[model samples]
Target chain A: MAEVKTVQECASMVADGASVMVGGFLGVGAPLQMIDQLVANGTKELTLISVVGSYPGGGFDIGKLTAGKQVKKFIGAHIGTDPALVSGYNTGEIDVEFNPMGTFIERIRAAGAGLGAVVTPVGIGTEVEENASKQSFYGKDYLVFPPLGADFAIIKAKKADHYGNLCYDGTSMNTNTTMATAGKVVIAEVDEIVEVGTLAPNEIGTPGIFVDYIVKGFSTDERKAIFGEIWQKGNKLK
Target chain B: MNSREIIARRIAQEFNDGEVVNLGFGMPTMAANYIPNGINVILQTENGGLRFGGAPKAGEQNPDLGNAGGEPITMLPGGSAFDLAFSFCIIRGGHVDATVLGALEVDQNGNIANWKIPGKFVPGMGGGMDLLVGAKKVVAALAHTDKAGNSKVLKSCTLPLSAAGVVKRIITDKAVFNVSSKGLELIEIAPGLTEADVKAATEADYQVATNVKTMTF
Candidate 1:
């Protein structure tokens, strides 16, 4: 039996200092409502892994958390978009490990698949080597990036069946599908929930077994408003 | 011609026949229009699909099948999707022949600093770092000056770099330059443009090639 709850309930499961994997690229496909609930809950000293930076800045969920100093460490591909994260990093308020985007995604996928480690040539002779281990195989150099799994994986999806099976629309499937199996507890927030077997088998992106809980909520329209603010700020720049 | 079209045509000339190429966002995206007729160059996009054609007609765009820049694109025959692992396997595995990218700045040591500025917030670095290391050759298409009319070709970047010493050549509206161990060597200048005119627009000291000629359209 799958238990459905609210975003607040999902946030309650996250304790202070928990390691979490968040799904999305920039603002797309992020579990905005759940992130908001976490921010409101005021859980501090967290380790966050995401592809994008904090949030869109001016009151976005990720940005607010970063600004509130809830996060202690961050591992991801880029932080250029989030002013709070960048400022925090530069000011030594937070620790950051920057992974290449593709490599970051692969590390999460490798964790989900229960792989110990994966080898790639992306970070060879680059700053990515600062944290990653390098090894040679068959006379070729490769960087060994460890698989990343979190205590909780929070993600957004388009729809879900009563069984907790998930479906994502279009490119929204980006990182959520892989993150489902990369965490000890997978919490999903969906816009719509249907009866069991309602979703076509072929449309199921993540099986119910990988998902631990489902949260029902509407993502706030804050992102569009934030974009407007950013655009306004950009227009004023010389 | 507009700056976009000029940079696009210049990048198209850099391609050899039957080469596999990846075009990063901005001016490099325009190269799809200028690929010579009968050339079988395959365009690999980091967003999962490969063999993308020219821009899609209005109402025919599928957001899921778009390029890295989120622009509507047409898929050529035999296009497919693989996970990020396999997509980069083609990249870091050295299957791509060349990659053309847009840059914010290029320094004397061939370093690119396109990912960020000190105070301004921009999207984080995408596949530029991976492509720079994976592709056999790197070509940058950009304007010679910043929007504030400052020179972007510099002795060294003040901003954080996306790739270190990987730029092979740069195709800009004012001139063409190749990065050598000895620093930036000017290979060509736009027709009717003088060496002094070009030098005043750039911050770096440039070595003029003896065989300078107008870039063929």
Candidate 2:
């Protein structure tokens, strides 16, 4: 049976040197409180997979962990904003794996979907193929990215019922749904916790079966403000 | 007219009867408003949808349905959604005919500098790299100068480039320039603007276009 707990309690479930997957794109829908709790716990040698750059100007999330040297490896799409991760890579303090944004997300989804690998032509001849397995099929080269399963997946949702049915609005649906399904243990931090069956079935982005734990009663206003600004301004391609 | 409206009107004139194009954030998004009548251009968004016609109205925004920039956008008739991977396949695979993007700086070599500065807190390089690499033709629209009046058209960019040798043309408030292998070629001047005036505002070496003409207003 899944347990209901606080963000700090959920953070306690993570051990040192664990491989973790976090859901968010540049701080949107990230489990900020849980991340802070994990930082406070001071676990060492963690590997973090994230879609976003991570944290408040590099003061939070995987950025803070990377800054503290707790994160030993980072698998992310971009690190343009995280000074700690960028500088750490330059100084050889951290192992960084940079994948294309779309490919990175698909790798996580493949893990969730129980797929062994996903073949793509995106990084076939590029640096993205470095350290990745490659094969020739149908006279064309394809890069086979292995699924990235995690010991723990920390996700954030707008609201959840006691049964653990989750719903996210808009771009918030980026990676949380896949993370919920890919982790050995899934901990969801939600703004509201209501009675079971109150939320309509069609509205559930992640069903109750995928979630192993729930952390209730955390305010997500700060995260919303951070994400809203990025959504409004940062997405402009130019 | 406001600067945005003027830029929008200018972009609308670039479209033909039937073209498939992608619009980047800022001034490029404004192009949706300027699409001319009788032109049936399909607008492809990087986040995973394609629509034609125009921007969405207020209170009708869908979170799941958005452009690459995460803005709530409306879909035209026959609009469709795909995964982000397939959406980018359309970009990097050269299926996209053209892309209009905004820029912070554009250099003589057609390099784009829009993602970040040295120490700013911006979310850098969302999808600009893929668009630059894959688009058939790239068009940049930006202010003629920075807030401090420094030339944004530079000899070389001081910031990291989004793409090298990808920009085909640039349209700024002061003038229009075509990016060539050698360098920038002055093509059209904004109405009532002089060659010396445009040259003084740019830090790049430029040659007069053989067919230089006044930009359509």
Tens digit of per-residue lDDT, candidate 2, span A1-238: 4568988788988999999988765555567778878889998888888875664367655677777778888887677668888777667687877766656767778888889987765554334567578998899777788887899999877788878888876445667887788899999988778788789998888898999888873455544454445444544211
Which residue pairs collide in model 1, if any? none
DockQ of 1: 0.24
**Which residue runs does candidate 2 get wrong by more than 4 Å?**
A60-62, A131-141, A220-238, B1-98, B101-126, B129-214
Clashes of 2: 3
Q: All candidates' lDDT scores?
A: 0.76, 0.73
lDDT of 2 by residue, B1-217 (tens): 6656666667767766667788876788777776767888888866556673333443333333444543445667687655455666788789888888888889898888766565553344556666777788898888888888899999987776666778898888888888989899998887778898998889888999889988775
Residues A1-238, model 1: lDDT tens digits = 4579888888999999999988755545668788888888998899998866743453564777787888999887777667888878888788887787778888898999988887877656455677788999999888898899999999877788878898875445657788888989999888778899789998888888889889985633343344334434434111
Give each candidate's fraction of reference contacts reproduced.
0.21, 0.13
Q: Per-residue lDDT for B150 in model 1?
A: 90
User: Would you list the clashing residue pairs of candidate 2?
Assistant: A26-A52, A170-B63, A235-B69
**Model 1 C-alpha lDDT per residue in residues B110-174, reported as the tens digit of each score:** 88877666556445566778888789998877898988879889998777777778889988888
The TM-score obtained by model 2 is 0.67
Q: Tell me, by lDDT, which candidate is best.
A: 1
